[model samples]
Target: VRPKFIDYYCPYTLGGHFINACNKDGEPVCGIYVKVSVERLNDISEQDAIAEGIDTDWLAESQDNYDCIADHNMSGRPTAKGHFSYLWQSIYGDDKSKCWEKNPWVWVIEFKRVQEQRND
Candidate 1:
C-alpha cells in the first residue's frame, strides 16, 4: 500500500503520519507507515510507489501537505492562525494536551479478512 500525507505534527522527527485513504469495498483502507526525512519527502512521489506496484488509490485522494515546527525543548503555543491552523488542532482542538506536538507518533492500523461461522 502507498502512504499518503494525512496531517502534520511538531514532535515527529521526520515526515508526519500518513494514512491509506482509499475506500475499498466501501470501507476505509489503511496503509503501511514509513518514517522519511524531509529531503526524501521532496524526492519521493506517489507515482514512484505506484510504479513499484504499491496501490496508489488510497494515496491519491487523501494527501495533505502542511509545515510543522517542533519545540522539542519547550511546550507548544497556539499558532499564528489560531489554534485550528494545523491539522492537529482541527482534530484535537481545545485539548492541547492531545496535540501531536506533545506526542509525535503515528499508528498504522491494518485490516484483514477472517472466516465466518456457518451452521453445521
Candidate 2:
C-alpha cells in the first residue's frame, strides 16, 4: 500500500480595516484573503513503515474520524466557521466553544471525498 496524500483547500480571511465615518475615502482595507493548501498523510501506516524500512506493526493506528484540528498540541490555530465547529455542533450537539476548549486538536471537518479528490 502506498501513502495517499490528501489536499485540503482552506479558505481564510484576515481582519480588514474598518470604515471611518469621518474619512471620505473608502475604508482602507489591509488584510489577507487567501487559500491555504493543507496536506494529510493517508491511513497507510503499514505501507509507510515498509517504505521507510521500518517495522510496520509498531506504527500507530489511524482513527476512523479522519479530520484533525488545530490546537496547542496540534496546529494551534483557531477553529474557523464552516469548518470543524459547525459540523461538530450539528452532529454531536457539541458547541464550538466547548469543542474549542476541550478537544481543539480533533475538531476539524473531514473533507468530502469528491471535494478532496476532485473527481469529475
Q: Name the top TM-score candidate.
A: 1
Model 1, span 1-120: residue lDDT tens: 444674665364445655545554334354343543333212323444344344334323432322222422213432332212244455665454756345444332233433443459
Task: Assess every candidate by TM-score.
Answer: 0.20, 0.18
In candidate 1, residue 20 scores what lDDT?
Answer: 44
Query: All candidates: CA RMSD in angstroms?
Result: 17.9, 19.5
Candidate 1 vs. true structure, TM-score: 0.20
Per-structure clash totals for the candidates: 0, 1
Residue 11's lDDT within candidate 2 is: 43
Which residue pairs overlap in candidate 1's backbone?
A: none
Error of 1 at 15 (Å): 45
